[model samples]
Target: MSRRSLLSRAIRSNGEPIKITIDKSGANTSAINDYNDDAGADIEIRQNKYLNNIIGQDHRPIKQLCKATLGFGRFRTARITIGDFESMRIIRKR
Candidate 1:
């Protein structure tokens, strides 16, 4: 009998691009405070406890771990978190 592995992965996301800045002597401290409040390091740690899981040290598309067969209807997927993918900014790709 063949065996399959079921791996579980967890991801935490806050939708936004991270901005970096230098703390040089600025002319405006208020602006700096605002920017700092709105920005910081965007770090994500996916924990996978199963083999072939997306969160393992070596990973694949987390979305692939999820299986869904869409048929006879339009499929709308949101915030696909299983992969190391870019943001869906909803801008024109063409």
Candidate 2:
């Protein structure tokens, strides 16, 4: 689960992003810089905590629920479970 591998996997799955907003983590900044240099992609990185708050807030419930379960056995299972949880949350909101 190195940062580069994670970033590459995300890009591979979701396609390249035009910009990315992240916290002020040097490792993440370095990884993005390296990725841009190696791949010749210009993906802007913004390190503002305020911009990331919405994402953090939205995941709080999922994190709480998963924390109780001690995590899923596989990535697919986690993805599916979280997807279901998010769907239900959205439905409840409407």
Candidate 3:
């Protein structure tokens, strides 16, 4: 799918975002701008590599576990597996 449609679908599913931090991809920038114009919504876009590090850090452990398992065969199983992993992590932290 094209980047514009992909971005629009994401916003539709997740609801409109107030601000988005993205890499220096011109395609992504153009998509966001198009979405803003089409929807007549002002969504702030920040292009900063460092701003995305927190999201990357949070997903690191989950990615490592999935990599070791060679990935899940289905989306449902993956979602449940990751949900359980997160639940265990949260409980352990308490």
Candidate 4:
């Protein structure tokens, strides 16, 4: 198989979304960093990698990647990232 196909298969094989916390400037900070300290361009690179994986996986819903559960009862629920769910003040859909 081609390298692209192999890489795509490898990313999909994980079966887990790499949880990422993106900063206001669109940098993907580390999950362990509560302060969201600026880590420079590496953060953006990591975030892009995770995003690429997600897209490569065909946007499959992976529970591990879900940072928030929204809505309840007759509402359209969704799983969101930690940063968006908390920092952005998004209410739970469920």
Candidate 5:
């Protein structure tokens, strides 16, 4: 890709961090109240501080997409991450 394209992509990604949650339960229910009612599980918003910078992405008042979606470059070169992994994937391409 050209340098201009790269800059545009980076600019579009305002470095907003989206919020994510982990459901320990293996079952998937359509109703959120039912899920909460199933068991009184503590609801805590996960804001991992370790994921501040990976590809020069800021975390303070992170950029958010909708409710839980983040944007980053497509210069990956490593194994995929699991849902449990809260850290953002940083890939530096040559």
Candidate 6:
């Protein structure tokens, strides 16, 4: 494949569920650099902290879309169809 076609395919979104795994045990401690400095620390993954970070990152855009749908009639009146995975497929005829 050409470089341009390869890049275009890579950039396309294939709508997939993201999975995250966290180990509560300290067995898999990953080292993270505190700063650009050489100093580093090993930290275990905490479920609550991971969940909070995931929620913070993922929920904002969804909430904004919902808000826009409510605020704008054009967005609100979209023809919404529920697909196989319960994913909403919206089509705007306008």
In model 2, which regions exceed 4 Å deviation? Answer: 67-80
Give the per-residue lDDT digits (tens) of candidate 6, residues 31-52: 1112112223233334456776
Tell me how far the alpha carbon of residue 35 in candidate 3 is from the true structure, in angstroms, after superposition. Answer: 0.6
Candidate 1 per-residue C-alpha lDDT over 6-27 given as tens digits, one digit per residue, 9 for 90 to 100: 1001112434323322233242
The digit string of per-residue lDDT tens for model 5 on 1-94 reads: 6433443354359632233232432222223333334444333334343442443353332334212434333434122222213344233211
Checking candidate 4 for backbone clashes, the offending pairs are 70-93, 70-94, 71-92, 71-93, 71-94, 72-93, 72-94
Candidate order by TM-score, decreasing, is: 3, 2, 6, 5, 4, 1
Error of 2 at 27 (Å): 1.0
lDDT of 4 by residue, 1-94 (tens): 6433443454459742344333233322323232224222122223355656656564233333452343333323442343444433334433
lDDT of 4 at 33: 39
- Which has the higher lDDT value, candidate number 2 or candidate number 3? 2
Q: Poorest 10 consecutive residues of model 1 by lDDT? A: 2-11
lDDT by residue (8-68, candidate 3, tens digit) is 9898899999999998989999999999999998999999888877777877887888788
Candidate 1's displacement at residue 19, Å, is 15
Q: Give the best candidate by lDDT.
A: 2
Residue 50, candidate 3: how far off, in angstroms?
A: 1.1
RMSD of each: 18.8, 2.7, 1.6, 15.3, 16.8, 14.4
Model 4 spans with C-alpha error above 4 angstroms? 1-32, 35-45, 49-53, 60-73, 76-94
Off by over 4 Å in 1: 1-27, 41-94
Clashing pairs in 2: none
Q: Which candidate gets the maximum TM-score versus the true structure? A: 3
| Clash pairs (backbone) in predicted model 5 | 15-63, 16-62, 16-63, 17-62, 17-63
Off by over 4 Å in 5: 15-83, 87-94
**Candidate 3, clashing residue pairs?**
none
Score residue 57 of candidate 2 by CA lDDT: 92
